[model samples]
Target: MPPAQTTAAPPSPAARALPAARRSLAPDLARGVMLLVIAAAHAHLFALMATGTDATLFGTWDRIATGTMTLFADLRGYPMFAALFGYGMAQIHRRRSEQGREWPWTRKLLRRRGLWMIAFGAVHVALLFFGDILAVYGLLALVFVGALRLSDRALLGSAAAALLAASAFVFTITFAAGGVPQLPEKPQGLLGELALRLSMWPFMIILMTAATLFPFLIGIWAARRRLLERPEQHLPLLRRTAPAGIAVAVLGAIPQALIKTGVWTDVSAAVGAGAATLHQITGFAGGLGYAALIGLVAVRIAGRPGPIATALAALGQRSLTFYLLQSVAWAVLFASYGLDLRVSTAAGVAIGAAVWLVTVVLAELMRRADMRGPAERALRRLTYGTTAAHGRAD
Candidate 1:
């Protein structure tokens, strides 16, 4: 059991808002890069309105773009995010518990944070991106708050079981139903698009929540182990898992790459569904691999991470703000209220990459000025209360 310090009151929220002097760079760095992958993945999904990546009309470069996105970006980015979510949650829980905050109060704080996330997500989905994950994560945090208390064995077992079951469920659904659910059509009018977004909320929320649970659980497990937080201590383990996870994830994703690239476009429905399932099943590796690789990088730079690393880490530090901004860029480029333009897959990916670069520069500016993201500041205040939310600009 953790030693208790209930005698002393917890630190003021304002003071707590300050950055950790010895913060782990791995998580922030990983998240910093992860957003790019996410942006690219999401951009491709929007591009789907134009045509399938594998469509015969696509030029060689387009096909190559689709294949690259398929193998490296799609079905791959979410795992890292999910794992990080769990990792961060564990950190929060542990910090409070160690500080002598009773479980009841801490859990309440977490649930409240989750509630705010849901609200943010609703607004985000309604106005900007249909692929928002904030609300799903918010709901997951609330639903799984109690799971943090579970023993390591229980957590790992549950994660494994969920992984298998979720994969099977997705596979079965695709296999039986022919493909995934149909998305709501893009509306040319701003109001119409908002309405369509709100309409699709129920289905998309359900899908995102269920699909991401496995990684969330794994994240919790990793946090308990302090995997990312203490990379130096876990180097041996990281070295082993990093390569293995990538290999599995890459290999498993091959079938998906083939289908998405149109190389195996003519396969039977059932066969195609199986390929999709294979991608889902193996995606765990991708998520785990990303975290591990980042962990290794963090270790290497434990002493000194130069300007580039510092900038990336800053972006990761304020990931929520950047994440939302990514959609805003997408909207201007693709939504009716904005450019209302559609491009080939390759072009879209390039656009996504360029937009992400913009954020990197923005993040560096924030870092240089020592400012926190506006969204993060608001969230901190909301979660902890006005006085408690007091923080430096950075």
Candidate 2:
């Protein structure tokens, strides 16, 4: 009898893509969808504020919608962005080392990126929304440069610790202060709000720094683990993670939902506000879970392109452009001089979704034309110090 032959199994498409795939369409597709969710929350808040209504019947419906929005808001976008940022940084570091270049240059490049982001974010906050994230992300990226050399285990441990400590600190401070601080009894005029935001800059830096860095570390860790490299290897992890992520997200949301709905009395309000820290903690956790789930889905859907993924990838590829565009559109629609729609809770959501849909469609069209979103094109020029190269915009 002929000797039996043994063969190794072929690499799954996702596994084959591995490290290279991090820069491919998958992560960008996830980011594109996640950004829409972020936009929806912001837009909805602005729309509701503009409407200037309380929790009437319509308001009640809005609250329900807002509650749902909160789930997505709390668990989407930022973490994924942070993670991918970390992964990109690592890849850059790896490429540099392979090329026998000194690593400090990468740090310098990241610092420049951070500064650019800060400048961009400042303009965004001043002209658009005060809640802009780029400045925060930029500053946090500067901080993460120090952490780049840490092993994956150290990165993960440090991230987890920082998250827990930050959550506890926020909760303790808010509780000791007797509640979450408000903008004051009277609406601070626009200038006043701007002043208030500036006043809170230190705290904002602290909060956002912790929030951004930890997720970034996790992303670095994910890259090191080849989690994105082998989606099937991580599927079991996702199955366990997704349910827990959803549960934590729901639990974290319950107190905030109750407070927003007026179901919690003063005593409960105190308890719930303290518990809102859990919301932030779980929100981050849930965000991680969702990222894992998306990765798994991407693996399954690899080599089988769908409209949704294609559209999302386009948006993601041009994320910088879309991100800036979102701020521009929101400012025109919601700022004091524009539509002046300051609608707070529910209505903000509806408007946000509408804006996101518009942006997505426009992005898709732009991709078809082989044109990158203007902001993205500019950023690429700045980052690479060269004219744009030909490829899908994303």
Tell me the TM-score of each prediction against the true structure. 0.95, 0.84
Note the Cα lDDT for every prediction shown.
0.82, 0.66
On residues 253-272, what C-alpha lDDT tens digit does candidate 2 reach at each position? 77766655555546443575
Span of ten consecutive residues with least summed lDDT in model 1: 48-57
Best by lDDT: 1
Q: What is the lDDT of candidate 1?
A: 0.82
Per TM-score, the best of the predicted structures is 1
- How many steric overlaps does candidate 1 have? 5
Total backbone collisions, model 2: 14
- Residue 204, candidate 1: Cα error in Å is 1.3
For model 2 the TM-score comes to: 0.84
TM-score of 1: 0.95
What's the C-alpha lDDT at position 336 in model 2?
60
